[model samples]
Target: MAGDLYPDHGVTGTENRQYNREQRAGKHEADAALYKSHQCEQTPHPGSWRRHDQRTQGPLVAGYGIYTQGQEILLTFSFCSSLVSGYVITYFPLRGRSETIRLILSDQGAKWTEEEVQFTDWFTANCEHKKQAVFGQLPKFKDGDFVLYQSNSILRYLGRKYGIAGGSNQESALIDMVNDGVEDLRMKLVRVLFYEPEKGTEKYEADLPDQFSAFERILSQNSNGTRFVVGDQISYADYNLLDILHVHLALFPACLASFPLLTAFSDRISSRPKLMEYLKSEARKNRPIVPKK
Candidate 1:
């Protein structure tokens, strides 16, 4: 563009290319320096490494992206200010995947902490704390520097390590079955809650009976469904299922009564000493059951 506008400027094509390249380089370098000094910036997309001048002091404020020939190449970067725990899950401050994992940590009394992220600053930070995430999704588990993705996979790893998965292969299989069911419901509910809030409520209301019925039957099969979802003790399956139930009941208060076993199961799990205390804590209290208007 510079060369086209100034035909008499005596700049050759090769010189023009080099000149433009240097101009872009200078822009980025200046932007970087300005960001480091001021702590943040508002930049357009379709570019590389937009810096995150975070107000908070922590590890790797975030990562940015690169756009080349109409393709986006995501690059992750970090500016570590302090050492975070070996066990950390970075996600939006919501009780979604992270919450289930939090339940695991709370129940097991594990040494863990959180890395809550902000969406507005996500891409600018070059994916920041979520760089190691498998698909750039949230609730990524970082053990020291080793990162793990997929919420359920992290839960399973912890479950296996902590002995909460189960004692036998058969038991693990059962837990998987329950966990799969939870995921199916979770996906649907997520679509409803986030994307289709207006129409989803009525549609989900119609589907509730059948959905709750399936879990009711599962609970009914296990020794009259008087206890946990599987086996005689608490398993990793309970946390996911319990979270699903929590959201379902919050959205549809009367939906669980038809499934007495599930209702009882929800109450029982929510009453567990550690979990009950968690329910009463500021974390759970502060987090809204559904997205706010």
Candidate 2:
């Protein structure tokens, strides 16, 4: 569905309605207290703190936090969205391609709001949003006044903006490679899901071992199959790979049987404290991967 000419969906409703002014003030105060307690080296911004240096070793890579002796003290500070309230994702009610972006935001503890568009409205002749989109497609992303289209482009933009793209230029290149690889596989899956469910699914299942081996090898090549995909720290590519793997698991329950590293990697990424909470919540569970046409 996503690779089609039109792409997915979006809405023009209120931006990040879940967060109110009072909630913002309360969170800002809490962040200040956390900053004071940590004895941070940098000054606090209006709503949040700056990101920790990538060289610092800890559990978190993007968020503001300091590493103690063998312990990670993550500070819930997102400088990118601090000045403003938070990011707003305008897409269809389904998870679709937007889920990866949502996972990165939630894992980083960044505040974001969803602007949902109903299917009835999306296909209607009088759909104003269709006329407004740059490419006449959905899954549009808005960061303050800057609006971005194309799901992968949005992911890359956020990855760079939030410091989760990669640690170095080389790692960034590797990350991009991994993301493109995932996109290729995802497009194949999309063809099966949206275009030819009967014949394509059978072939996709038959080629599962060959298709998944690359990801498995990637895990083994990096840190002896222990940490994330590309680097020691988590990158946006990890989020993309994990999301696609998750969808594959749903389609074929035994998909990862031959890939031990991938299974463990999925388990580790899914166990992240903040991401775990979001994964188990109704907001994620209730949304279908592909719409019921």
Which candidate number would show the highest lDDT if scored against the true structure?
Answer: 2
Give the runs in model 1 whose Cα sits over 4 Å from its true position.
Answer: 1-85, 123-125, 291-293
Candidate 2 TM-score to native: 0.74
CA error at residue 117 for candidate 2, angstroms: 1.3
RMSD of each: 18.3, 11.5
In model 2, which regions exceed 4 Å deviation?
A: 1-84, 198-200
TM-score per candidate, chains pooled = 0.67, 0.74
How high is the lDDT of residue 51 in model 1?
A: 29
Per-prediction backbone clash count: 12, 0
